[model samples]
Target: MNTPKVAEHIVNWLKEYATNAKVNGFVVGISGGIDSAVTSTLCAKTGLPTLCVELPIHQAKNQVSRANEHIKQLKNRFDNVSEAEVNLTSTFENFKTVVPSFESTAKLDLALANTRARLRMTTLYYFAGLHGLLVAGTGNKVEDFGVGFFTKYGDGGVDLSPIADLVKSEVYELATYLEVPTSIQKAQPTDGLFGDSRTDEDQIGASYDELEWAMQMKDAGKTVEDFSGRDLEVYKIYTRLNRINQHKMVPIPICKIPNNLK
Candidate 1:
């Protein structure tokens, strides 16, 4: 891809969308991941006020540091860039206290992890409402469309998605072009929702590269019979996730009323 041209295109598109919507600018949740870094940078390039909000709920140190580093780098590079950090650890704890307790299980862990994302989503919108900015999403093609790896109505809830068309590799390419902090560019991709060191690869059981290849194969009408060994394993993983998470990829289901009944 023509990195410079693509970057400029996204910047112009973001500016146009914001102007058309009559919003002041964009507000993005900085997760110290490649997607968010590239996305926030693109918003900054539009010369509109881009607010980067950090909502950490028991987040790991490395993730926090990388987020701070990126925000600092962005501010130095773009005058329109601004930041806010909201620590939601206490709020999360309070939420858990009110909810009924359950024995720790993988299901419980997953639910709580999703809660963290929803809280962050709420916080981003709060800032967006206060500042008259749109909530910019930080999801990419593989994670957003291929695997459905994000939380629904959580990180998946957004006013706009600037990089959802790009794969993880392309997002990294943009990150390099945008001069995002080296620490963030090098950090392992994680949701940081679980409040641990588990990487995205660990959770998905496939690297972004492997998932991207599987996604391409699926798009080309490939089937399970196409491979063997680890290739088959990865293919199955991709297909299973794509099948189970269709709800995230598609629009919400709405029951249609029969015209005769109405």
Candidate 2:
């Protein structure tokens, strides 16, 4: 509903999660976008030590700047706001060098893009483990459970998602309620992978609004024929992502032992 109540509910929910999981605080990657801004704000409101990280590659000046702005905003809202920046260019290059025939400029879009997501997740978990805080995913419901716009074992792996119930549009509303900076709120949603060539919406082939609509219909257990053409396309992407990334979302499996023999 309103900003304060929405924020309060998120904070309370996070606190309960932390208590139940026995965690000291929460950590999230602030990508200088609305989703991260609102997520950071919620973590701040929880009064926990919220650590925001900025993972930048070459030519990501704008995203890096915005991430700094996000950290500034968080400082005003929370007491334990701190930031760490890690450059991923060298690591990305190294990975490519070691893997024979691993082309960084691969034709397969997911191959290149997923590398960035995985790196960001690594950096987030590094801090999460060091600080004894749970990694708070910034993915919204539309992205995570909807189109599956997250990388398997990457952004998809998280201790908890505070905004998992909010779609992209709802996240913006919450951002407005919290008085998040206009620049951060209105910025284009991007994964900041290729800076100019690649973006979240570009790869997903639809806007968050379109994806949300399709997700709502599917979540309600509606049939596919009921959806519009654009919505149907988005739903197709969601279904494919879910099937392809099934292993990433599930726990590790072990070889079964014969009960009678044991």
Candidate 2 segments exceeding 4 Å error: 102-109, 227-232, 238-258
lDDT of 1 at 178: 89
Global lDDT of each model? Answer: 0.94, 0.79
My TM-score estimates for the predictions, one after another, are: 0.99, 0.87
Q: After superposition, which runs of candidate 1 have C-alpha atoms over 4 Å from their true positions?
A: none
The RMSD of every model to the true structure, in order and in angstroms, is 0.6, 2.5
Residue-by-residue lDDT tens digits, candidate 2, 74-107: 7866688877878887888787667667445546
How much is 251 displaced in model 2, in angstroms?
4.8
Give per-residue CA lDDT, model 1, range 1-262, as digits (tens): 9999999999999999999999999999998888889999999999999999999999898888888989998999999999999999999999999999999999999999999999999999999999999999999999899999999999999999999999999999998998988888888899998888999999999999999999999999999899999899999999999999999999989999999999
Worst 10 contiguous positions by lDDT, candidate 2? 102-111
